[model samples]
Target chain A: MQNTPHTPSPETSKQLPELFQLLQPHLKALDAFLETQISEFEPEIRDHVAYSMDTGGKRIRPSLIFFSGWNSEGEIDPNLVKLAAVVETVHLATLVHDDIMDEADIRRNRATVAKKYNNATAVLLGDALFSHAVYLATQFPTTEVCRDIAISMRQVCTGEIMQTMQRGDPNLDMETYFRVIDLKTAELFRVACHLGARLAGFEDDYVKAAGAFGRHLGIAYQIYDDMTDLFSSEEKIGKTLGTDIATGKPTMPLILMRDRLPENEAKALRDTLAGNIEADVPYWLEKLREMGIFEEVRQAIFDEIHKGRNAIRPFQNNPSAAHLHTISELLWNQVAAL
Target chain B: MQNTPHTPSPETSKQLPELFQLLQPHLKALDAFLETQISEFEPEIRDHVAYSMDTGGKRIRPSLIFFSGWNSEGEIDPNLVKLAAVVETVHLATLVHDDIMDEADIRRNRATVAKKYNNATAVLLGDALFSHAVYLATQFPTTEVCRDIAISMRQVCTGEIMQTMQRGDPNLDMETYFRVIDLKTAELFRVACHLGARLAGFEDDYVKAAGAFGRHLGIAYQIYDDMTDLFSSEEKIGKTLGTDIATGKPTMPLILMRDRLPENEAKALRDTLAGNIEADVPYWLEKLREMGIFEEVRQAIFDEIHKGRNAIRPFQNNPSAAHLHTISELLWNQVAAL
Candidate 1:
């Protein structure tokens, strides 16, 4: 791995907000399309689906789709909005099921679907959303998008299954950790770009490049997210924080820390995790912080971000490609604060 | 609606087992294909998936696909085996998720996925299976089968959502009940036939007839299933029984009995259902049985069978179509004894 000190400054973070401002109209269109798509469901399901959809997020996937679609040098397809809804609904469906699996209460400062209704309703609701997303993908004239979506979906579930299987293993290797993230996070990003570029009628090379950019960016984003979950305050994140340890989920920081620690201390930490240490989590968190593991995690995030930016460096001069670069930089700036 | 007394005799029911004897080789081929399909998953997931798959049911969906595929007056495509696996996997995925939603323990005389594994693992496994099934569907040349699968999947979920919404409502109308079964049960059956016939290069009319056969048979199967759940011994059914009542699920017998009883008695029964009457279930079951609700339910099952068989009556002389009719009768025989 090439180590480059290309961390973004605070000013780099402001660019995304401006981009968001420029892209606000497209986002609104996606929102409307999503609402209309979900309206066909039964009234009860419609309410639950709307509730989950309306729970605001950064809309990162839609931005990727929109930006990638805009790169085609043609008028963006109206169908792109529908595609955005499909991807976002897919994202939302995964989150709903994730919340249930994690037994999480709050997400985006609100009760999770599993908590809001019940597990049974939440499970069926997730299934319904997934089916709806698949159906939406089928509306496209080509089977290519549906094929990509299906493969990406399978990979996502594979990641989840891998993660579930490896839960509580603090000694999980960095390779396995990266593999999990690659499947779980990066595959969706890769397909989002793949779909966006293909739908925009881009040639095969640019589509491949776009997918690479997304893959690296997604890996970087997930590493940064794992770091934030460990280091940031629950209030700052506006959702459940430090849950990776509590749930015995093997994430980057834990894997790194376990690898670096003395054998006895690593075993002790694992024992604590294996035991009823829910109340003792703060102590472990403080110890890991005092050990400066967060600094190492931050460095790892920067390395990933640098790799992500370099993948798209060839097209950085293009205005549309520059926007993608700026998004990567913005992600770096957010993680640098940790 | 037509109360025809065209019930099958024991001799007709006996034909299915003989057919199964002849079709054993095809069933084994399907089983082998299913194994290969699931073998691609991670070891942990592979075990869970295999465990769930091996805890066999009657292979009804695959039989539908196979019988329909064989309808063409030409050689059967090797791809049909993969399609059978896809449909069966889809069926298995739904059952896994449904078990989690129902908190069911036993299925096919063994522990359910949710019981054998944890709910989280079971949920992810179900999702992985669904994705795998979709991926398998995409392997075909045409987009039509994928679209049908996606739509059928969405409709199935819609039915589940409708059923979830109407839970505990003893006054669920017959029309709405039929609609739920149509969406949840019949859609898959319809799609199974549609795909099978399409794959076999059957004519459009035969395809339509096969789908009709599957749809009406699916509705009849669900009705018979609900009746079996109400009246059969758990040891005989080899699955958890009486869960519909415990979960407040509205099924045919309850609906029919409630509609047939005196208003005051119906209200009392509904109150008992709505309130804490877990221990009083035996008393309610006795009352319904004493009221000859089982007889009414049996008659309803026979009526549905008549309609199901009638849907494919045009091709009754064809060997393939006769097998379809025999399958429906077999399902009827199982529930008739209840």
Candidate 2:
């Protein structure tokens, strides 16, 4: 099995969505700004800092920040650029630590910090990255940016801790699952949009709406990600399928399947999830397909995306809202295609 | 050998120094303040946060802050209390992460967070604590507190990373050792004193001097800690001795001993540090005593303490400076007792 779930890197323009073309200059400034931050770290760990910062993920959170703070002048706001770097750096730091916990060797087609260095170095490096992110957040004029970023970071770790504790538990409920995703993934998304809009001098009402839009969109994105772990083919996703089941992570599809199966079958699946029995990935995959869990999970994703769209509907006249809607449309298209 | 070196917990009045008696109300305020922080964590992980924060170690950093910001009015400054909590929390967070890297089962006379829960939980808990610390730092009106704290946190992690990389390396020099300790240990101490004095509205020159005092005092304290890991007895220190040798961590005494040994003996010591052979800890310990390395290392610590005293000597008329001198004297007494 592949080490990590595959996600297309945003290195090439083709891999990015069409809306990203508008963010070309913003992202360019972000990349340059991030490059300058390597020197901010101590000389010894600068190489590791640079390596982790070069993750090349799709930068979805940065996109949220930029779009929510979009200006009519078409000029990059250095403050927004700094905010993007802060959020992206925090995301990258989480990824570094996550790789250690998952014991995964590969990330973005390169050796993870845990694999390249060691777990100890990976842990400390992740910490250094986190500290640097907060340091960047403190550069803002007011305490709001750092305060929001810090709270979001705490929530993100709390979500991850909850997930780790529930890893092999077969009875993780749907509500708990949603709560975890909200804290871990959506919290940062909410903060990015909220802070970006606030920093851009948006009206209070519009900023609140943007944050709600981001929260719902984040939920939708995580559901889609979890769905791909089970439903997508190795060829389609460029990574191994059924990893969520293999690793005994009770995601939406598996949770739904477990509840729908016969008592005997459900007991067997529970044993598999609890690691009392060897994981039969093919059997579970076949069972999920036969039970039509895929369509059910897809609907859940659509529902979240719809709710996200409804959040910003009242502010359609705002340019920032329009840009945010465009980003959501890109996600909608991806989900519909799947 | 025991899993970790022991430091006295400041739970008892007798265990504390004469000055801490004066700060009883201040320490009580810090405890109450820290207790309030527990609810700030997510409900799911509050127990773990509480567990890690109940370390009961000598709150040296907090003491530094309180002393550096001492007021003649004898009223506890809430800002100084918040600052103390921030630095102390950062210290505890580092200890949690350090326990994981050391794989030590015990810290401050209890199961470490890594041992009590798991490495993954410990990692995330440390992260949560760090975020909370920064969040508290942001509560101050200006960004200076958060900014200095973030930078110090980064340097602390950088120091740990360097030390981790240098593990089992036989050729680590004195200069690198000092550099690592300065980054890992002294940076926070320096920041605590600097910020404390600045927040108390002291003269700029005195603030700088206080920070210098803290830096030298931190150097002295770490040297004393490393000495305890090798020279002190399990009964005396209440944990273990010679762990540095067992763990292949080269400290001042070990380094001095290694360099002073005859060529063949030095090669064997180097090999032991490189983990090519079993560490004959008793032989090394006896050799350390025979060669008078204890006195040599002790002298190094005394030199740093003297330097710290000199840094504050010019500010003798100030109450804060006098308090800082008394703290240095406590360290001098501990070393003298050893």
Candidate 3:
């Protein structure tokens, strides 16, 4: 399997449906919007924030916001572009703090905000970005958009707090893991679609369908990400791999592996993870592979992707919906390739 | 002179003005509103947020929001109650993070949130509170109120980031000090009044004047706080003192002391401060007193209070406006007694 970056370019996206070409122009516009959105009076903050913005990743969340707003009739509101920028800023803010919490040195093939600057700077930058994003949301004429952003952010914080509390707990159950991912990842995706459809003045049913599509897409995306953490190399992933293991954070693969094994075998894996043997990554990697956990996790990812595909099945005939369907497919393919 | 807590109770507030008595009912309502606002799916978060809210301080910002909305004809919008709650939540969020940054053990005669909980919990709590507050702001029908809250939060972050960047610099000038306070402190205060007046549909001049009032009041309040840090004891203040000195974070007293002393003497003070003689707090305290820096700082506080009073002078003819005027007078009197 070739380890290609998941981030898509105009040329790469050309292989997808015609909707990809439409998305290209909007993604370019989002790039333009994001470039100027980070300016601050403080020179250092301005530069650091700009640096974080410039080291961009796959703009999946913003794409959801744009594509959700693009209905079958091919109508798009200009305001959805700003909403995309706002949601992307929120994502960036979370990444800044997430890096600090994980002590991650690299992200998107560059030093993280915490590593490049300092923890305090990174924390404050995250707060600044959050406030700026809220400011941008309020720039919209309707309170509904701003309200959705705030609620999504609240849910994000709640999920992070729950995840933080569950750290080092080897016995963290599957239910709690699902809840955490739902809040932390799926909530943002849900809100992206919610904001896009709502701002486009779609009916409540369409808006809800859009949200459902994003929620499943996001869940599958996160599950796929967990698989990559277990299977991918640092060179391929461009991040500090195995942090979830090192930090004793219970993710899908570990939970599934422990649950499937015999009681004694599960206990051994748990002890190895909970202990300080995490520095010897290859040993655990070999054990996990020998246990066939990656194969099981790949199946789990496919299961989620199936659910994700089913979520947007109603919108399949809408033409523009193909773009969203392609998103889930591309994410699964990216993970499967790794 | 006698030491008194600046956080007034119903009994103490009754001694000042009839307006305080009117504010009492609203403050109680806000207290009730806050009790229900901290709800999260995670029980630990709900409990921690409630605990932070339980350890109450001077509700000065909420009072500003309430009083600024008190029109001359005795009109008050019920929705302003929610706005007051929103502003107070933002203040609490900042306090939670501020305690972490300062490594403060106590606040409001109780363990600080970071001390009671861990730093991770404290950080997430602050973020949660911020998101909740913004969500509350968006509950308003118009976007103006939400936009004001967002802008105010941005300025607050800007000030904090600037302060964090400038940490351990002994030679921070008065201009920079003023700028930091104006952003970090006065901006929120200004917005509380701005939100209140705007929501109440006050005339443009009245809204502008109300903002000016809160700005000056906040500056005076912060300057008075800086003075107490230099002059008050830990027992009297009910919190850790001399953190600014210990952390080498430049404040008003150090700036004033340096400016007043001869070149060699100023250099010596800076060296003593910039070095790790923070444990010898009494020695620095004695030197500052001998140089009459406390007196100078008190005078500066008075100047700010005077400006604050002048800001609401035109409104004084209104019966409700005298309440705001009395606020500045009482604050000055409180500082003078100290």
In model 3, which regions exceed 4 Å deviation? Answer: A1-14, A17-21, A40-44, A71-77, A239-241, A276-284, B1-18, B40-44, B71-77, B239-241, B276-280
| Residue pairs in candidate 1 whose N, alpha carbon or C atoms collide under 3 angstroms | none
**Which predicted model would earn the best DockQ?**
2
Clashes by residue pair, model 2: none
Candidate 3 per-residue lDDT, tens place, A300-328, comes to 66666566555556555554356666666
- DockQ of every candidate structure: 0.59, 0.81, 0.60
lDDT of 3 by residue, B96-173 (tens): 878877778888778998888677777777888888899998888888888888888888878888888788776889
TM-score for the second chain in candidate 2? 0.94
Clashing pairs in 3: none
Which model is ahead, 2 or 3, in terms of lDDT? Answer: 2
Query: lDDT per residue, candidate 1, A1-338, as tens digits?
Result: 34356634332323777877767888888887887876777654678888878778888998888877674343446777878888898899899999999898889778999999888878888888888888788788877777788888888888888888788776678998999999999989888876776787766777787788888889989988888878987877765667777878768787777777899878766765554454256776887798898888888777777776666566544445566667777777677665
The 10 consecutive residues of candidate 3 chain B with the worst lDDT sum are: B1-10
**lDDT (tens digit, per residue) of candidate 2 on A228-316:** 88877689888898888878899989999999999999999999999899999999999999998888888787778667767777776
Clashes of each: 0, 0, 0
lDDT tens digits by residue: candidate 1, B228-311: 777988887766566676767778888877888899877876765565455256666787789898888777777777776776
Candidate 1 CAPRI classification by DockQ = medium
Question: How high is each candidate's interface RMSD, in Å?
Answer: 1.7, 0.5, 1.7
Greater lDDT among 1 and 3 belongs to 1
